[model samples]
Target: MKHHCNRHWTASVLICAALAACGGSAEEERAFVASGGPDTPGASPAVAGAPVYRALSTAPLAEVSLAPSDVDFPNPERGFYRFATDPARITATSLDYVVADGQRLVYTPADLSAYRTRDLPSSYLTKLNTGFAHLRKQGLKAVVRFAYNYPSSEADYLNAQDATLSRVKRHIAQLQPVLQANADVIALVQGGFIGAWGEWHTSSNKLTSPANKIAVRDALLQAVPASRQIHLRYPRDLATWYPVPPTVAQLLAPSPTAAARIGQHNDCFLASPDDVGTYWSASPAESAALRTYAQQASAVTGTGGETCAPPVAAQARMACEDILREGAAYHMTYLNRDYYAGFFAQWQAGGCMAEVSRKLGYRMQLQAVAHSAVAAPGGLLAWRVSLSNEGWARPMNARGLALYLARSDNTTVALPLPGTDLRQLGPRESLQWSGEVPLPATLPPGSYRVFLGAPDASQALSTMPAYALRFANADTAITGVQWDAQSGRLALGTTLQVP
Candidate 1:
């Protein structure tokens, strides 16, 4: 009871437009592959041929910040510059990049550092703000982290000095304007500014003390708006304050507080027993408690980090399977591509790289879509959409889902779906959504192709496809209408008849 169409590669939007205009008498549907290939490598066969579903192909998806980020210090040894001062390297394989802030802040006196804590000079602020604009121009978002110093040796780590509480607070206060101005391009901000390299360890200051940590955390909370989350270096850091996870009742009510806004990042992820100082526990019982707290807390908040040098038995202990399993358990949202190259190479050789990359963050795939075969203009169209999240993490931001009606004449109308909040969709979770869409009376009478779009809630980015959510579905083309490349909306692979 299924028909497959041959896949062809053409950049023309007219082809999609033509597909959108096709209307037939048969009350049937055909599923076609957009990428002309099997699902993303390692996808289980169970979901195959499950209606017009999208399969993540062998391509790097955007918007999800992975490894080898865009921002780094000017390393003479590595032949790298501090920031992207020249043209961005636009490669087919690259996605979003990580911008680790404060790398220019040396581990010396204020005059020795390129940036001073007393005040973020106007020139420095302008340069910092330009990075976001550059990313926007390049069709990318930044995974941001800030640190005042990078320790080169154990002696430096032991002797490192951190900025005063007043100075740290002042720096944050100064950066508020830039943060607010470029919030759109910033994916998430890591809680930095403590210890060496901002990992919140080996600090000359007492930032690690429970009371001081709370004060600093509160400052970060107030500095960044509630819309974005501030991730901490350790799970115990957050558990010290927001120890208990949000109850189901509280989550159902959807009450979000600043305390709940804190998330986790394991810098030495999967590198050792207890992940190299990430979790400091003496007994198995205590370790279980910390892990439980982190898993529960991360269910609602974001978690992401990178793996350090694994032990000699890394292949046996830190295999791809273990990494994926742990990533799922921790709800990890991002990873550092620049580090742990050898481990990544091992995964590639072991035939697990594609699966790991495809499911890195939020991998949402359409399972089945049920809808009316025919509907009059300005009439009711009931739809039931089933989606599966096969990724390691859920969407941590507020996103809007809507039905896109692409007419034969290249005109499009977007209708928002009520009660479709993507934040509730978690990894390995199946979402069954049903809604009645009242077609706009102003809609023209013609055959239309129905499409699903997860657009940004921000007006500035709602129309930009780079910021839109790309579903795991395969057939994204609409043959009957010119495709909006800027939005990357997915066609439902079926047409609606209107007489």
Candidate 2:
């Protein structure tokens, strides 16, 4: 699912790309798929099989009995690396799965909880505002690649019979106003890496075509102030991405070459029973499953393609191996062969969510600050926050705004009362507020998840995410906060507990 990168792909290259989709569709899904994939010959049949993907609680969350330690990164290195993950394995996880390319994300309760529960080390979040934050500091603006996660495919994009241009036009029409509003944060549109969450495929639902790619990219380019430029980077794979410094004709070409792509982009974490690829020339079962998932994705996105049966582990490898060989000039990476390191390490029967977090770099994060000496016991914790509305629009209608506060006991508490919530802040109009919470007289002696938004509170376009507070030595709590330049302020908000 590599979005409309315009990367060059021979029919054979596209055929073999089945394995490379991140999340292969995580990112062919820009953030998931390394670069992207292409349609393949149909699969043999459907194999009915499944994995224990932690099913979501149908009813409301009845308060999970989480470990006292949550949200704080167990490792300091993870945060530093996730933003700039290795390109090799990054594409292996479905091309750009870890972090989709054109997708814009606001923290959700699930994400916040996962971080807290896993005790994500300082690595994934900000130990200090460096790297990406530094990029912001350097005046390099960022634009969210707001692509919908549907299973459309290139087939639809290129559907000459269908009035797809109208649909695309409507999408651009809808986005134009929003883009104009958040003009500050938005430098240019990278178009969507849409389809199957932007996986560059034409089967199942996520589909796009050379013509459609031109339309989307043109839309993005047209929206920006010509002074700024756009490039579809992020979850890119050398073999699959559109080469940089493209020719004007190449840029205009519906089918461009991605074979010359270079550099680090994305290919997030892949721990799955779910693998996207068509193991053609193999068994019916393997072919069937890939077909089904593609269809499932297709049904959602309106792209059309084939379906097959479920694949076995070897089949998964077979499907992936088709495109990940040196001789083939197709390269890919997986967690490992057999996946003992990926699944067995976490879900080895009764490993629990924490175990999954462990392999996920969750456990790599340090535990809650159990024994830090609060330097100034009497100093009230205060923070400075800046909300830079540099995005394409005033996204937050202020539906839900609250700082999710957790303690060392993994106990969740919401901390929003009357008179909280930011209204519409135009482009550069950001909001900065300071709130206070008293530290418990006796620290419960655990970690903390101090958040800004409420459960599933993703609507708010808050630039910074609610983060875990590390009581390094009492008097000090560290969080992965963001500094908003447009607002000319530092975004900070977190509660404290002294254990």
Candidate 3:
């Protein structure tokens, strides 16, 4: 039970005496008592000459269900990386892939018989389609990457017999049907099928050249749908083709170009001075330009990869501070959770695991909300919602934002909130939007609590409240505050009285 002391009650009584002597309206004093009045011991004491505005608690909530990617509420577009298609890979708490996971698949293109014909075996097709179909069923998305070989591969997988440009084109062409069909579950595709480990380096075909890189990238772009983006290995790879990347404003603009669709994937993050050739230039000036490109591109497009080497003996490894700094600067949306267990182990040991987990993707919180206390059934219900982003990246996916009015009978009416685009909510920024939704003329006349909901626009998971975007705020319980913990909807606490 909530506990309050008599000390605040005594202080409020003294303040009421002073307010009465100063000609305070009896109606105003009565209003305060009606609104969880100070007569309830332990209520906040009013200031000597302050307006008696009714205020509710705005304190930060505990790190319980509100945390990002938690089992109950899975937010999209950001979170820890996962390597395999195994559903068992999720954490005991089901925190992994709350945003999305990285799916890196390798193939030996040398065996033309395997992919030479349009008549690919149903088994091979099943392998490709099954993972993505499962992701769709689970209500998840993934960053997909396909490679020809690895850093260490069996001799049978050598590039001497690998697919040539023509064969690679045909391979991508064959994969087009599956790729387009699964675009709903695919976050983006990385330009792979090149150098060792598909990092676009050390290829037997010398695919590192700018011309070859462009050709491969163009082929992949054609293979994947325009709705999806393709990530490059290095900054110069993007700069070489586009010459000029999109500005922050341009990235947010409608109808971005294919050039603007390109993103970055730094595999050797924090491994060396040049990140183990992820940045090949020796000149510091050139390195600075790459950094500038990465930060800018990542703001709009996705930027993510894995750590290659953990620091040795007190070196600047991927610590909690570095995670926050780089995540914000580069707007990293995802990371490989498998390879560098040691790096993350250190983060866990340092006691910042919770912070990293909470901020890995987008952590949207309600800063303040203002709305009318009463309205007619057919009247306008106006609201001003102030939200703050505490995560490293913005939500790039499309989601539906709507107002939920729930009656005492446990029924809810969903009113579409027009002109609300959540993708514009940038990292670590406070965004405020005000809108008036027209209440249905047929809405039952009763006391209905107001709530905000962001659901998958596809309507595939509309009934799944756990799949909704959970906000980082304290008032989540429906009975007291009308918050549906199963869904990420917020109950504004103020009731809308309909006459």
Candidate 4:
């Protein structure tokens, strides 16, 4: 496969001669000449002598270790303690407080209980928009859910808590504009608006039927932008839409269909063998199938939730060993850190809290990098990166990867790595991306610092430092590579000279 370079200017004849001297093929020289050369107007003519071609290969001088970070940094989509807030209650100060506590994800449930019998008020819709604006300003994303009620008592559970199917659809239509407008700040939308707490069960309106569930799921998929996914409360609900589990190839495919966009959220995670009816199957074989599907599907789509208090018999499964094992198996991205206080305390006392915190999402660390030591303007600069994802899951949201060339003056130019997708880098998976990118013909000869950045795919947040992915590697005497928080780039600790 031929990898096309994204340079605007053409390679000069001198660089072609240098390439030939460095053992490049005749066809490669012709391709570069055709791309841009003296034949073009205002193009610089090739010099008589060939430029120096210096190839350089370097690995970390010190041993690269996978040490967990003790400091909390802002990594967009994945993390612990999804701070919950009502749309009306969200304020910049409140969000700042959460950010100060190292939380990047917020959970906001748009309460529609009062409007169940009618359409959502204009004021309520404004509150929703305002809340999203706050999240954007605070450099945060939200796990949004629109639910009718929160049943706190047995009597409340027995009452008609949610609107009818027709009303639910209308409400979704009303919220569509807000959802699409603020999709950039939305992490994922929970499949809510059905039962109490929107867990897709025990609906007083009896909206839990298979047909009804499918309707709500489809509506939600349409209401939310295709870039964002919808998370159901149970794995069985997803199996209803996709009985056949996705193969490894499909899960790793570049583009996903709407069906693949539906994921799961287990509110009562690890509460029981079935996770409090999350996998509601009496038959052992059927239960096994559901569990397997959840594991495989969540690998691509994403999954996470809070821990419920387990019974005495189920407490064994809540230990550190089980937690880590199952966390990797299901590919959890985020978990509610506040609800299960006892379990959190237990993990701390048992000496696994730090590791759990470190591995909650995508903790990518640089292993090595190789590139050309020197190159002429408009010449091919071969580059390669070796990295590993140490976290339990890859980034579920869309992300763009680029190699940045920055000058000492802080002037920077980004060369997009078109085909590199961070979502494909799974948990515990190592990926090496290598390609040749041509330096701009107008680029001045200088020593440039090379850095790598994985920014949010959306243009609106792409340049924001808080939305950029951070590497797990720390800056120390041993490991030269370090994450630059101010610039939102990972310094490769290597330099490229353009002569």
lDDT order of candidates, top first: 4, 3, 1, 2
Per-residue lDDT of candidate 4, residues 1-499 (tens digit): 1132222222243344445443556555422331223443322334556442232212112123334455656588887856568766687777787778777888887788888889988888898888888888888898888899887753576664788999999999999999999999899998889988887877877799988887887788788987888888888777867887654355445656765787888887776887767787879899999999999888887788888776555443677887788888888888898777777877888889878887887888766555555655766565555678888887877675787888898878787775567776888898777555667778888988887888888888888888888877666645456778787887767777776
Measured with C-alpha atoms, the lDDT of residue 222 in candidate 3 is 84
lDDT of 2 at 368: 20
Off by over 4 Å in 3: 1-74, 86-123, 151-162, 310-316, 408-410, 476-479
Ranking according to TM-score, highest score first: 4, 1, 3, 2
Q: Mark the regions of model 1 whose C-alpha exceeds 4 Å error after superposition.
A: 1-117, 153-155, 247-255, 311-316, 373-378, 476-486
Query: On residues 1-499, what C-alpha lDDT tens digit does candidate 3 reach at each position?
Result: 1121111222244335434433446545422221223443323344465333332121111112231223222466566656643221222333334334322121111222334224446566555676665566555666776655543443434443234566667677877888887776677787776766566766666676777777888888888877677877888878777767665455445666777678888876765666666666879899888888778777777577877663343443567777767767878777777766776887887877667666766777766555545555544454555677777777756564677888988888887665556666778787666544556767788888777787765566665664577777665554344457665577666576766
lDDT for each residue of candidate 1 in 1-499, tens digit (9 for 90 to 100):
1111122222122123222323212231231122212332211133455433221122111111111112221110011112222112323222233224321101111121334346667766676676566666544555566666766764677776677667777887877887788777666677877777677887676777777677778888777756677888887777767767753233334546765677887777777778877877888788878889988877777577777676545433367877778877887776666566776887877877656656656766666554545554444454555677777776666675787777778788887876666766778888767644556656666788777778776677778775667666443333322224555676665666655
Model 4 TM-score relative to the real fold: 0.85
Model with the higher TM-score, candidate 2 or 3:
3
Worst 10 residues of 3 by lDDT: 55-64
Highest TM-score among the candidates is held by which one? 4
What's the C-alpha lDDT at position 200 in model 2? 41
TM-score of every prediction relative to native: 0.73, 0.27, 0.73, 0.85
lDDT of 2 by residue, 433-483 (tens): 432222333334444545433222222223332221121111123443433
Better of 2 and 3 by lDDT: 3
Candidate with better lDDT, 2 vs 4:
4
| Candidate scoring better on TM-score of 2 and 4 | 4
Q: After superposing candidate 2, which stretches have Cα over 4 Å from the reference?
A: 1-163, 179-199, 203-207, 218-275, 278-310, 313-355, 358-499
